[model samples]
Target chain A: MRLLYQILWKDHSRVHLLGAFLGTLAGFVLLLAGIQFYMDLKAVLSENRDLLDPEYIVINKKVNIGNTLGLTGGGFSEEEIAEIKAQPFADQVAAFNSNKFPVQAYTEGEQVPNFITDLFFEAIPDEFIDVKSEDWKWDPEKGTIPVIIPQDYLNLYNFGFAPSQGLPQIPKGVLSMINFKLRLQGQGRGNYDDYNGRIVGFSNRVSSILVPLDFLEWANEKYGYFEKNDPSQIILVSKDPTDPSIIRFLEERNYDTIREKLKSSRMNIILKFVLSFLVLVAAIIIGLAFLVFLLSLQLMISRSSEKIRRLNKLGFHYREISRPYILLLFLLMAGITGLSLLLTSILAGQLHQTAEAWSLDISSSLHGVIYGTALGLILLITASNVAAILISTKKLCK
Target chain B: MLEQDTSGSEVWEAESLLLEQGKPYVVEAPSGRGKTSLLSVIYGIRTDYQGLVYLDDRDLSSFSSKEWSKIRKNKLSFIFQGLELFDELTAMENIQLKNRITAYHSDERIMEMARLLGIDPFLQRKAGILSFGQQQRVAIIRALCQPFNFLLADECFSHMDRENSLTAYKLIREECEAREAGLILTSLNETGLPNIDHSLKL
Candidate 1:
């Protein structure tokens, strides 16, 4: 009845109801926005992964005092290589093969400055190298050794060393045209051979100077005299570079890698920690707001206790008398649901705009899970508040 | 059977008593004679008395709150001595609160009864601002707006003067006769009313 509602609704404290409404709304918006941002960031993190080939990580033992003193070998043994191959993150593993003999390279043409430098060579299977070249092969009869050096080496020389040394920076094509001779030294002074060497490509994946695997094997067989040592470095390909276990496993085994390669994996761990903490805080606020909602409604009902009993005496059932309170609860719940979703979507839009300046692709709309979570939580709060309302109202009636 | 533990009483001390339909019964007693308690018991609001009250062969104690609500709506009505009117509601709204549920009386008939009880000018005023006699008249009109086999009036006319009491009582009798319902009117002293076929001292 209109009069029934007018009578019962008059006793409600406007401050209490408004406080409950705003409190619940604030809690819901925080929770929903946290979820939306988390999903978007996760998507963006994985999206960048799709732009590149699978990650190749080069790992070596940490250099400590024992390794410096030559007391311990700073390389992977047969058992250690096998253990690394068995790891879940290792999709493919290859050990670096080094030259067992001494080597030296010198420029012979006037187009480049005459220089001779001692060098060491390391080689892995061709598939792990990022650079592709037809000249990356060994031919004993042709007597030409093709070499691949790190791109960072050239960059360091061009950017750091050339300007300080008053030398011109040579481009890659000019470097390729220069002719050089490599002298391989065996056990005796006369037991050596010289071969022509050429720079074929620069590698971004591996940091050391590289030669074709077959040429290194052949040269080691012919000129090797020093004691054989374990491989000093191993390169592994991982399809999921964002897997945090890659970093954890490396740390546990005292292995080191260029940390820039696993930046995404570290970011993923940190993002998960921060988002979970955000969700936990949201859950606590929501829980406390729910209590305020329950108490506010209960207080309203108890304030109307006399009118409810009077209505009951006039032939109104307890359920009938509880109509006003139930309607109020429903209205507030619906408002919270609608407003929270709107606020979360606005937040998502803001994040999308900010991420755009960084050239990151982020979704501006809310995910389906956001809607589902909002509805589920609102239903939960509304149902419990409704039960409390009915119970308190029934207590006041005959 | 109806029973209670009051000495020097006719209805309470009696082994059994039956109040029939289409009859007006006056319960006469001084203050503190359990007049309101007797009406409340019959109305299913009080169950503490040591007695068995029956309506149409059904025990009063057996009725659930839902059933009691239904009974109150269609089979029983009470004009409580406290009036039970919403103080914030206008007199007309208080009457319509009950009338709207039953839809038993039209607006014209309600206005006519208010005019007869001399509360017509105050119908639009809040019940809390009206005098006790005016609030009592509103409660009388409210009780008469429902369909009931029994009308329980617990000293409802105590606030009104003799003439207003007689006029309200006549209206009650007319409504009861029209529905063929019974009336159990309790009073603190001798009311000296007319057309009351039975009087019980409690």
Candidate 2:
């Protein structure tokens, strides 16, 4: 490093200082950007890291129960369920069902959705509400648990039952939206004539619709028309996706794979793209900076040609004369790289700390520092060439 | 035929001539006569020309560029016609730079030469800040530290007064003899260089 400094700066002290400062600054900018981009990706990744884990099997099949169609479809068989339970990777299978929590409440003066006639909300089952439980201890007296949902669901769904047009309005907690299609022949919004509505639970964008056993049973009988009860979706949780043995074990079985909720290898590709883009941007910034730095170096070299020639006259070799310059540029890069790392590290670190202090609920990430340093080094190496050695043939002749 | 040992030639030809070891060889030549080129050739900087140039009984062409540098850097020194001092460094720093390139430690040789060449007073000042004469004096000090066997002086004494030039010449000759090294000095006018035993006229 010292040798590099000598070569690059031996003849011109100011240039050495200036070039190094600029290089380090460039490095810093590159590093900061790289780290930032990495953190952002990491947040995205860490959130889904569990999803990418080898153990989780996301049962994703789209069941669109829109304005008219009622989803009365049944789920997996008893034998199939038993087979999944037998798999070693299957820790605990929680049966979670997903249907869009219908915002079919009476918007004043508008016809409500027909699917709301027998509002068959795919409520979270007793199994799903007690999903975290090891044994799913049931309270016989309480008769299954109601689900917990975010508060935002109430704003989107309002069951308007004004008494002016209604017979007798049942208050909240008395009725639940069960599976019954509305035969709304009139255009103006009207209160429910058949179904009883109750907010058993609500849902955020994430899945959180739960109906206790009694409610589910009542709704199933009223809406599904199924004599025997059957689930809609069975959630499969795997043990290890990273483990090839487990993956093979699962694949060998007849367990149909659901790649929808499961994060795929495409996540890895996205991460690579983000990192590569940051590096490319950094390289461009640094390349331009180095070009400017190299210009100064050329002038210095042009001037030193005579001194070099004279030194040669005294028995100095071309290599010896060029050594100091080479050494200088090396040190220059090291110094700049060091400085850049320091500067960017502090800024990025502080930002990271601030993020932590503020308790931002961002997820963990997809990429790291390896990508950042790789980029900086490539740029510095290319730039040093411009600064290294360029002796005019005319100077040689002199 | 044995060449005539001129005192110190201010001019020289660009010919492959045998130079005696441990002798004060003066280069007398016009500006474009390639005195610096010959000097550079010996220094291993001029690589394109084809000829036999020997150093310490080894053919210059036989050694690799790296090997040549090792040999020359340790055993050589130059006095640029323009003095070629680093403008950023102080006068003393400029003189010591040659020594630095040669891996010599301390400013002892540089300071000693500075004292002898009458540039010691301006040693602390930068080369660009120094007068032309003062810069020349610093250049002489640098060459003195080079103690080079084959000093290729390219009119380093051009700006110096006759008295200083003579002193510079005397100092150079004394240093060359002490080191038992060769010298190939160039000048347009032969007013200063002294104690030369051989001359090459271009």
lDDT of 2 by residue, B1-202 (tens): 1222223443222333567667776666667766777676766666666546677678776877557555655666667665666666678766655666665535676667677777778888878898888888877776666435666677777887888888888877777778787767777756435456676576
User: Lowest-lDDT window of 10 residues in candidate 2 chain A?
Assistant: A178-187
Q: What is the lDDT of candidate 1?
A: 0.91
Q: What's the CA error at residue A234 for candidate 2, in Å?
A: 5.1
Model 2 CA lDDT for position A76: 59
Worst 10 residues of 1 chain A by lDDT: A44-53
* Model 2 vs. true fold: TM: 0.53
lDDT of 1 by residue, A138-244 (tens): 99899999999899999999999999999999899888877899999988869888999999999988999999999999999999987989999999999988888
Steric collisions counted per model: 0, 52
lDDT of the candidates, in the order given: 0.91, 0.55
Screening candidate 1 with a backbone cut-off below 3 angstroms (N, C-alpha, C), the clashing residue pairs are none
Candidate with the greatest DockQ versus the true structure: 1
- Share of reference contacts found in each model: 0.90, 0.38
